[model samples]
Target: MASTTPTQIDQAPPVTSSGRSTGRAGDKIFAGLSKGSGILLLVIMASIAGFLTYRASIALSKNEGNFLTTFDWNASANPPVFGIAVLLFGTVVSSIIAMAIAVPIAVGIALFISHYAPRKLAAPIAYVVDLLAAVPSIIYGIWGALFLVPQLNGLNLWLDEYLGWTYVFDKTQVGVARSLFTVGILLAIMILPIVTSVSREVFLQVPRMNEEAALALGATRWEVIRMSVLPFGRSGVISASMLGLGRALGETMAVATVLSPSFLINGHILDPGGGTFAQNIAAKFDEANEFGRDALIASGLVLFLLTLLVNGAARLIIARRKDFSGANA
Candidate 1:
């Protein structure tokens, strides 16, 4: 038997100009498409920001109230007084409350689905969670307004009675619990499914070998999860929580339906009135004139900036942890 020479073994296959040109053309087309898409996204974002800033400047110039500190929103007045203090307070407070409630519950549910649940039960539960994520926000709003508000009255009373010393829970006046706290609860329920789904997916991706090693070292199921799963999924959970936070921040209908709009800043979240940015816009848009619309756009710009800041912070945290995780691995 004759052995092949080195040159013969290392010989390159013949290439046709037609095939090479076709491949080059395909590559150029794909590269152009991707570049164009990214440019288009940047352009769209810039356009939105520029338009909002221009309108906001016009409205601010005509304003009779401090934009940052004033509580009233009377844009239709001759001097057109308006400010975002109340809206900012409500938006941030409600979002914080929602995050505090939602994140832990979501993590627990994700853990249960990923590790604790019976194999037979996990699939169905996960399916239900996915279904819940797809349910319309308007449905949540309607349910929150008609059913949740009434149902929460007892709990609200109980909290005010027991936890009123906290001041945040204190309800001085007699009224329904159509407040920021209620809105927070509603937002928690609305965001729960998405967070759980994302966290579960992350947990499920944990390497089985890592868990098995922990088990072999006499670690219990919870111990294995703590040592292996949680660390691997920390970034994912953070991302999921941020997604839920964004949803809570921008939610309109549910907040509008559940919250009795007020332009005042109240520390008591169980009381009957507080307002969020999206809720404020939705509630006042139809009655607003051109200047009023500009003011709303300005508020929207604030919301947009807030979301960007949150996402940027989360990315920074993830980047910092990436090196630590890589080193440990």
Candidate 2:
């Protein structure tokens, strides 16, 4: 064989004085646009939050009691004073209930869709879930009010008869399903599709190599998912839960229509008391006096804060998890 001649090497283009190449202008513009958009969003969010907080502070300053701590929602009184404690309690409780009911079912549905289900079955089911998510919230409210409420009342009645010993199932035979429990159940149903869809997407992203490796190691399907899939997708599940909580917290018409908006906060889920922030706002916005409206705004501010806190916590958890996983890897 003839001796091979050495190939010529192409010299790299010279770098600009600014440490960037001429070809990077488009990239720099794109990055600047992206960062500018993010800054604009942050500014808009901050403005809205500041306006709401300012209004809430004005309303709160006029009230006699410490608005944050007091449980009474007597915003329409002679003194025109009240607190969001009841609303906060209701919001937190209802959201917790919604997350509890939606998350497990959503995760199970996601697992089934991404892994266990046959291809033919998956498409139709996925379409159905998407359809469910697209359905108008008002439609959900009406259907929930007319259809689900009565059906649930029947279920509640059965539970009353059989499981009333448990505090959750106790019912006072109200003519309508206007309780926190009913609202929470409806919220769970409304948010289930969102959680399931997100979780399905997350689970689908689980590396094929991981699954194949587990199987090659003689792990069963369920065991493989339990070890490799779940741990990987756990952060995604938490993010989905937080997203669902945000929806549940901000939900207005559905909860308003489904629940009885009493100022009183009752520990019993079955009791016809306790009103969430969005419910309180929706129920009273039209009829509420100026003070009542401002008080509602104050309650909304709390809810906004609560949602921000929840989302932040979720992000932090995901970040820490990524860090730990990265270090391990």
Candidate 3:
């Protein structure tokens, strides 16, 4: 037999001249579509931000008053003057109240569903939560207007009679349900399902190994959750809060239905105080003049800024936690 040469052993498979690696045609198409879709989405977001900013600057340039500090939102005529202070305050206050009411209850319900409820019960409960999310904002607004408003008169009466010493409860009972407290309650109800669903999913994702280890070490169920589940899902909880807050801040119809429109800056939740940006825009945009439209756009710019600030703060908190954990590791 002829001896095999080293050259023959060293020989490699032939390659096509094209630099592309071999892959299925379908896979290549899918990859291209995915990348193109991402680029398209990014471009769309950037364009929207740019357009809003440009319009807002034009509006601000035409106004004579300080846009940040003024309490009123009258934007009717030429050289129109309006500010976002009252609107901004209302938006922030209502959202804060919503979160305060929603977060704890959401977490508790999520925890119960994931850890305590039977499998059959859990599925139905989760379905109910998702259904709540699917309910239209307009429906919520209508319900708030018709049902919630009527119910709140009794609440208002109770607060006025029992808690009258407090400034928040000191407002005269107008027999109308339109108040900041009512809006806050409605917002809380709307946002609760979102936070609950997120918290449930996150809690369910906890590692069984970590939980088991905690259990094996003579830890109670509550202790195991405290040691392993809550800490592991802290970031998820924060993300859920931010998501719920986004909804609360931007919700127009529901708030418009529940809150009595006002231009004054007041310190009490029970008082008819001020309107949010979404409510203000929705209530008056059609009636607004050219400069009024521009002013509304400027107010939108303030809301855009607020969203950016909130997201930035959340990121900072997440980043600092990551750094601290890395250092400890």
Candidate 2 backbone overlaps, count: 0
> Model 2, residue 177: displacement in angstroms?
1.7
Query: lDDT for each of the candidates?
Result: 0.89, 0.83, 0.83
Best by lDDT: 1
lDDT (tens digit, per residue) of candidate 3 on 145-169: 8898888888888888888888767
Error of 2 at 108 (Å): 0.9
Q: How accurate is candidate 3 locally (lDDT)?
A: 0.83
- Two-way TM-score contest, 1 vs 2, winner: 1
Per-candidate TM vs. native? Answer: 0.89, 0.85, 0.85
Tell me how candidate 2 scores on lDDT: 0.83
TM-score of 2: 0.85
> How many residue pairs clash in each candidate at the backbone level?
0, 0, 0
The prediction achieving the highest TM-score against the true structure is 1
User: What C-alpha lDDT does candidate 1 achieve relative to the native structure?
Assistant: 0.89
Model 2 alpha-carbon drift over 4 Å, by segment? 1-36, 324-329
lDDT per residue (tens digit) for residues 1-329 in model 1:
24667667568655545355677788999999999999999999999889988988888888899999999999988888899999999999999999999999999999999999999999999898888888898899999999999999999999999999999999987888799999999999888998999899988978787778889999998999999999888888998888888888999998999899989999998988889999999999999999899888888889988988887877776676566455335
